[model samples]
Target: MDSSRGTRIRRRVTLFLLLLVASSLVGTSRAREAQPLPTAAAGGGSRRAPERHGLSLDFYAKTCPAVDQIVASVTAARYKDFPAAGPAVLRLFHHDCFVEGCDASILIAPTAAGAAASAAPTVERDMEENKNLPQEAFDTVELAKAAVESKCPGVVSCADVLALAARDYVQQAGGPYYPVKKGRKDSKVSLAGKVRGSLPRSNSTVDELLRVFAGKGLGTADLVALSGAHTVGFAHCVHVLGRIYDFRGTRRPDPLMDARLVKALRMSCPSSGGSARVVVPFDVSTPFQFDHAYYANLQARLGLLGSDQALSQDPRTRAMAQELAGNKTRFFQAFVASMDRMGSIRIKKGRKGEIRKVCSQHLLAV
Candidate 1:
């Protein structure tokens, strides 16, 4: 072979080898990026590791880089047009976390098969505790999920999106901005029977609230800070009527309730239940702002629900509420910390749980 022919052959071979190596590297990176999160055992799905860990903020730094910003923008816009959406979304996140440890179980609607099992209950949303929850809260989650799906396809879980959405809603409502840990997996099952004792009741006592929240890694301060979210949401009249008009068969307003607030409550919620569905803000003073006003209301005996009043009735919880009411800055800091802890509850990280394609349904059978 001529020298020129040999040189050309050598160059061609070297170029081909380099291209092959580059292509291989690219393929390996794509595989890493596209790795599937764990789900209910399937034919070849990722397996759940024996140990479960909490999520991290940068869990999707490479795979879904804009997930946090996407959720923020979507929720902020919705909240701007509809101010009431902020508190509603926050409540939804709390409800979801209280049951099944922030696994997106609350977002699930009944499937055709589950609904057909009329003889036995199926979905969790049908439970009494969840039935009266504002549908707008669930709708806000839907918006956040839709936004995340559009940006990252199926990489982010609906559960994580909900956590982020709750943070965003709080911030938009003039509250503190909190960092949400990511990497939650959607639950494959949501049963009505499981919802009964998992959630906090409107009439729950301070002890009951503390016990339930403590079981999920929250302390007294966390409970107080979280309850401050009531600064923006409204309570159904029926939920507060007993505290205002009749207390434990007293047939009169609770002695702890303020007389003026009781009068206002009666005007909106008649004893005849004529307007049982009417709603009233938890924070009578600053209903639109997310601040320490809730604690202030508790101090003034203007709290709307029996549970809210219970906080001030107990010495330990009352001390926490008083401190939060005295310092808005401290309240914001504690609230942000508590919410972070709440979001970390029993998360399915690494290779457990699925990144649900649709937030409302399980990817695999339970």
Candidate 2:
């Protein structure tokens, strides 16, 4: 062969080998990126090992006794007639966190403007206004916290007390176990109106819900998983009004929803009332329990929100909801898995993020 031709052939071979090596590296890097987090159990899907050890659980348990005591004292001080107010106070945080992730910011921070500073604003509002608030749940945690404080001072936070109370509440109600991750510090800044703006509405279309979830770095699957929280709470008539009224062409309730139920919901929520006359807890049948009843209700067209029923229409989320609906175990496993994923979203970890003393102001805190 001519020397020039031979040289050209050798160069081509070298280029091809280099291309192969580069391809291999790219493949390896992608696999690493896509790998699931490590969980406590082998092959337990993808679970990232928690950074702090049993610290979260220990802190949660340690702080509970004090929180419980405080709750008891506060309820007694405030609502002498309503003796169960303490444990009810604790549910505010649990319901909020379970619906979202354990971002304690929801309890104290306002996600919007002009809203009053209150824990679990949406849920608590209906409860307080209608005198329907489950005071017992709040009383339980407050009493526990008070004891903890008497024993350990302010070492425990209302935030940690909330996590522990939520965990126990679910178990007592025969729901899946929700693990607590500790080391979450408290934020002093609170935003009231912000809650309404930040939360997904019952009338929200699938597109809107997708945007809200994505804004938090979640996807369709996460939205569906998070909606599983509907399994536990209930919606007041006011929440589903837009759906019945068809406001802005965006609040279309599912055709699958029971017409009778829809009519009743509409009638109960008169146009003139300010959260009065009628109430629909997010999960009416089992309002305080974390169970699959929410999904099961959706199957029967009894889903409280248009967004909840809409889950059945989306291809990606439909199967998940169906899987959870078919079996309680499946729902629990998926809920935990999804929560783990949701909790990891957009987290500013390591040197990348700071633990702000307040969540409402900004990531950096003013």
Candidate 3:
């Protein structure tokens, strides 16, 4: 009970906490590395639902009869206020799907109970690739979720809200109107460490991108169509700096880029450093129009990201990009089908996860 005894106890406790934090980080990294990439079907590679859970459009028919209309109205309302809302919502779904399936873990913030039970203290939104996700996207999803909760109470999952919101966003943006399956439960396990590894890098080749999608049963054609989502959004300069400035340590612009396109990019992002915050449309021709212009831009060698250009540069995906650029109807059909596959990536069902009361926080510990 002396002063020295108290001081010693406090120091020991501080050191113990530091060691525990370090150990948890190491454990998370190792576990993420050990985890296998998501895949669909054993060998069939069909666009059917996974064998474990029954995912259907009518999953919420009885519980929330007007679920789709509710989500569509809210999304359209948000889109009217924020023009970029379409791509922002779509990006959330894309990020959620590529990781452990469209389980809505990106919306979950880390919680004491979730960390204690899962031994992971990080959430998916904190990942570097996800840092630039527009604030408009998060706001739109939260608004839609609150609207759904008001009517349906706890019947709908945040995962389904996001998926349905994405579908509505696409239709509002002039893309195809597609059916999205429901009944997905929210996942509590979100690791900041897994996102970078799980996602395809901008500098990745066509082969690497193809492999990333194939793990989820998507083919080369699917990759081309999904990439078409770039049609509506804009990319910040940081994601395009390497390709515009020094690609491959050459101290020159990317050789694959059209000379005039390079000149135009330099105007937006100067050769002099420090414009990483500047923004440019994914397709300069029709940045606001959600259509086949993205593929058309690639044909003109004006792709803003390295991965975008890779689609037209690499022999494997090049032909598909060219074909999609030419045929608007074909592009829409392929995109709808690819979106269906992406939304079904990997999901948790009734007993596997919980319906979140708050989209940004895990369900409170009972």
RMSD of each: 21.5, 22.0, 15.6
Over the stretch 67-178, how does candidate 1's per-residue lDDT look in tens digits? 9889888887777666667787788888888787788988887656554666745788887787767666777788788888888888998898888888888888789887
User: Model 3, range 158-199, lDDT digits (tens) per residue?
Assistant: 999999999998888888888888889988678787687677
Better of 1 and 2 by lDDT: 1
Can you give the lDDT of residue 38 in candidate 2?
Answer: 26
Q: What is the lDDT of residue 136 in candidate 1?
A: 67
Local distance difference test values of all predictions, in order: 0.73, 0.49, 0.75
Q: Considering every candidate listed, which one attains the maximal lDDT?
A: 3
For candidate 2, lDDT tens digit of each residue in 215-271? 445566566656776655444566677666665565664466666555655545665
| Candidate with more favorable, higher lDDT: 1 or 3 | 3
What lDDT is obtained when candidate 2 is compared to the true structure?
0.49
TM-score quality measure for candidate 3? 0.82
What are the runs in model 2 whose C-alpha is more than 4 Å off?
Answer: 1-91, 94-103, 106-141, 192-197, 246-254, 271-277, 283-289, 340-366
Q: Which regions of candidate 1 deviate over 4 angstroms?
A: 1-52, 112-121
